[model samples]
Target chain A: MEFNDWAILEKRVIGWIRKAADHLRASLSNPLEISEKSAHNDLVTNMDRSIEQFLVGKIRDTYPEHKIISEEGYGDGSSDTNGILWLLDPIDGTLNFVMQKRFFAISIGVYENGRGRAAFIYDVMGDEFFHCLSGQGAYQNDIKLSPLTEIKIEDALIDMSTTWLKPNRRIDQDIMTEIVRKSSGTRAYGAASLELAYVAAGLLDAYFTMRLSPWDYGAGLILLNEVGGLYSRADGEQINILSRTSILAARPGLHEYMIQHIKEQVAEGKFLTEPQ
Target chain B: MEFNDWAILEKRVIGWIRKAADHLRASLSNPLEISEKSAHNDLVTNMDRSIEQFLVGKIRDTYPEHKIISEEGYGDGSSDTNGILWLLDPIDGTLNFVMQKRFFAISIGVYENGRGRAAFIYDVMGDEFFHCLSGQGAYQNDIKLSPLTEIKIEDALIDMSTTWLKPNRRIDQDIMTEIVRKSSGTRAYGAASLELAYVAAGLLDAYFTMRLSPWDYGAGLILLNEVGGLYSRADGEQINILSRTSILAARPGLHEYMIQHIKEQVAEGKFLTEPQ
Candidate 1:
């Protein structure tokens, strides 16, 4: 696409994100109809579906040629990341949305042939928007975000979920516990998009999760790339944006350190995921 | 003291908190001079001491009879919680204050004859002020916060630090892991005062910390009490308010459930803290 076309698409995406955010803010006063997804703890609310449907309708109305990959069932059934693709997670932290009524977000990313072009992650309640255009730069609201600097693991503050530290089916629990002990501090926000935005904004030094769908960290990946951060599979492999996988995002050198540490655990047969 | 006197003191305390908040907001733009505390991960900044001195001076000028128990050195040397006491934590989440530039608070609680009379926990950066008076009610900024209703453990979201879940000298790691698995989800903001305030506001169902100073959760305790919540030592004992101890804050019957579970662990020698 031409530069002018990219700019136009970016502006339209921002508009849609802002519109969805406005709807989210207005809907907070209404009662939420929540239902369980995979388990009782995994929740989905009425607003999550409605917001995804709204985004899908808007996208289809304007750019009918673009394919969508979304959390809710509003996306086209495309298996490959060919041509223009839009990844959307209407409510990134639905549990937080239903329980705390804050800390959730609307995350959207646009890619051309699997290369991220533009991304936006809006904290609906906090009113903070993190966006990036490929090669241009990343911005938090009006201020341009600076590239992330290197930090040591002993000084880094990591954001990770607690479930990963237990005996889960994916990653080794002992290795996850060792990571917690080695890091200076650990925080869990219960929101992947916001946590990724925080990492891009340099509020957190690193973030890792055992499993996340493409839509969950799609926009975050673009933002982190703009800020010179790294994101990959937990075992230091390139991520395929079309599938579910473990993720480890961090600053420049810290990513290698984390990968090396986890690789040692993998060598010991501590990791459950089969080597790709 | 008369009701009018209490009202006057509360207003004055609120004014001081707002003033301190203004100072904090202004100081965020400047570079922080940080220092190590007991451990390398344990940190204290210049602003922490300055804020404590400022609060102490205000209390001394306004009510010289009141004694203070504070994290910093500005507090009076009172070993007992006997008179009109003010518990102050200059900056509850100093690590976050120095790093994230958010999620920290200035916490204060007033006690008369060992009974909490009033409390204030101000999220300095977020512009949220949680305050309450005994027998009156709690308020979040301008809105009067409703009391927290009962919630079961399976349906609850807990706030706890990852450090406590590791094999620490205080508690058993396996017990902590079980607690994480049982909850709907878990979050760690790295700030006790704000976490406790979240509990009072019904944003979080429960919060537990293996170790905390008196000033860390002082105001939070009073706010929880007003909202019909309960707080006790991790071993299910009354917290002495003048010393360091573990804390478990939750709504009504859930506190007892947590106590029973933790006591069972204690009986099995999983809890290292001496039983009172």
Candidate 2:
């Protein structure tokens, strides 16, 4: 499809997705049906599955040739990103949504041949949506986001979980400590989609996570690109939209500085372990 | 005053406080008139003092005998909690209000003869008001909250910030590390009022901080007490509402277990200084 056609389709899809999510929120607000997934911290409720199913059905009926990769099992098990692929995280931050009843999001990204073309992140309770069409620009609701400009580390705030600083299976602690000490402030909002949205909104300067799936970050990638932000693996490698990747997305100047100094320091002697 | 009279007063005060907070939120959407306090983190805007002044003025006009203790310098500087004393934190998270425009609260507590009679925690953006009147049940909005009962440390979610976990002037990190490992999860929302409100609501099983002032936790203490939740110094000592104190508020079962093991450990020369 042409760029204009894709933009129109994306706007309509985002509207539908917003309506479906609002419906799900209303249905599950009073009496929620909850369940545990990988662990207690990883909570998935009925609304997650239902929302994913609704999105998948809508996409199937409207765009028959499109493929979907979703958090829930409703999507196809396709490994290729050659055609138009829709990535869906129906309920990002499920634990936050289930326990806190807030701070969760519905994130969707449309990509063509591994290049992100459109993105949408809807913070349900806040009724805020961050959207971007490739080369057009990023927006929150009706307001267009300004392109990220050069900001020093001391003037910038980084959004990252403290777990990254701990002795986890992801990254080195000493390097993470150096990064934290350099930034003005560090925050972890528990939802990757919202974190990405905040990065686009210029509320936060950067965000880095060790383990994240396509569903978690696909939408954010499109928004970041449009707002003059860059995303890469921990070793400064390009993110493969088809799989889980250690990701970092930041403004233009900060991204380069982070990769050369902190990223390299964190990945010292272990760069071979990163994807080729 | 009699219990029925106290109840009536609580209802009226809560309504007035809610109205006052809404007015502040609407009026102070931007920091066009902002200033610095003790430090950059300790932010104060015109609205902070204005809101406190309005509350104190209304309280004195409505009931001339009532005393007021507040963060802003608008209340009487009485040392004793004689008659009805109102504790006010006009904007509990001023840094958040000025910086993020969200994640802040208006905390108010009513005390009679040094005893808490009522508390209100208004999360302005979230539109959640957690409240309690002594002898009555705690509530999030209108729904009566369940009491703290039978929570395992392994299942408990604790509230804390990474800043505290680091070597700080106030707290010993050895015990904090153990607390981190033992709890199911840790969260830092940067707003003490809402954190305490969550503890009262049972969403967060526990919350603690190295230092907190009276205004930071007055309303939270009242709400937690109503739900049979415990709030004390980390060493299991009483917290003086007039002074800055170390805070440890948690569900009854987890509170005792944590204090006995964690707090006592820190006291018994098991301190681990944060990494250099």
Candidate 3:
């Protein structure tokens, strides 16, 4: 797609997302019909499915040719990211939504021929949106985000999940302790999409999660890409938008250093993956 | 002090906090005076100290008899929570303040005869305030915080530090993991005062931290008390606000259960005076 095409679509999709978010918010304000999916902690509210269906309908009506990868079961179940695709996570933080009624977001990303085109992440309760178009800079509301400044690892504040650091089949505990001790502080907001949005907004220098879905990361990846931030796997490889993989995204200067230092302590074991 | 006197004092203090927060928001908008504190990620900008000094000077001028305990070295050094003592945390989440510039709060609590009298937690950027006059109720931006609903462990979301689950000297990792697996989910917001405010607001079902000062919990304690929540040490004992202790605050039904379950897992020699 041409740049102008992407820009127009970006604007249109943002509007669609805002409207969908408003509808979803209203639905949540009313009593929610909640249920369990895989586990009790893993919830699937009726609103989740209905919102995804609404987003899919809008996308299909507007961009019929584009394939979709979304959280709920309404989108095309394509494996490869070859064509123009829209990635949607109708509710990025469902637990927060069901319990706290806050911290949840609507995330959407557009890719053309496997290259990220545009993205939007909206914190529904806060009414703040972080958005971006490739090569055009990232923005929170209308304020353009600044480029990542020169920052050392120790001086950086990170959003990290501690559940990933325990006696797990992944990274080493000793190294995780070192990172926590070395940094100014750490936070786990329980939402991968919002963490990435915070990174794009420069509220957090870095964010790492052991496992995340593409829908959780799709919109954030585009925003980070626009802000000159690096979002990749734990091994410093480019994130595969279709995989449930460990993610590490940070300001460019701190990403490599964090990965290098933390990688030395990772246990040598193949990560277990469930069938998608 | 009479109840009416406390009410008037709280109103004035709320106004002062609003004005002080306005000054802080303006100073932070420049983004030029940011500086590191203990680590790069651990920030202590000029704004923190200036704000603290400004608050201390005003309190001293207005209430000359009030004894103050604070993070910044402007308050009287006291070992006990004496008569009409004021606990002040100028910026509860300094890292958030210096980095995100949001999600941080200004916390203040007053105690008379060793009992919580009034409390205030101001979300500086969001313009939301969670305040309480003991025996009344908690308020978030003038809206009263409702009584907490009874949520079971399986259906509840709690807040905790990721470090607690790591190989820490303070608590047993296995027990912490058990709690995470049982709960609906876990989150770590990295600011104790605000996290406690979240507890009072029922945004979180429970919150626990390894070590925190009096200033961090005093205001939250008052608010939690007003909302019928429990705040105590990990061992299920009365919290000595002056000492660095394990804090666990939750709805009354869950407080003892959480403390009793986690207290058994305490490491024999893992106590730390300060949170890393």
TM-score of 3: 0.92
- Cα lDDT tens digits, model 2, B1-276, are 543477777777777777887787688645447777775456788888888887888778877878888898788866876777888889887766765677788898888888988898888877888888888898899999988786888777788776665555666645676677666777767789889989888778899887787788888999898988998887788888777787889998899988888657877886532211
Alpha carbon lDDT at B139, candidate 2: 86
Q: Is candidate 1 or candidate 2 better by lDDT?
A: 1
Predicted complex 3: DockQ: 0.61
Off by over 4 Å in 3: A1-4, A169-175, A266-276, B1-4, B31-43, B172-175, B267-276
Better of 1 and 2 by DockQ: 1
User: lDDT tens digits, residues B8-45, model 3?
Assistant: 79878998899899898888657646666544555566
Clashing pairs in 1: none
Tens-digit lDDT track of model 1 for A212-251: 9889989999999999999999988899988888899999
Docking class of 3: medium
Which docking category, incorrect, acceptable, medium or high, applies to candidate 1? Answer: high
The digit string of per-residue lDDT tens for model 2 on A189-275 reads 788999988988887788988888899999999999898888899778888888788888998888888778765675475321342
User: How many residue pairs clash in model 2?
Assistant: 0
Q: Which residue pairs in candidate 3 collide? A: A155-B40, A155-B41, A156-B41, A184-B41, A184-B42, B169-B270
Cα lDDT over the full model 3: 0.81
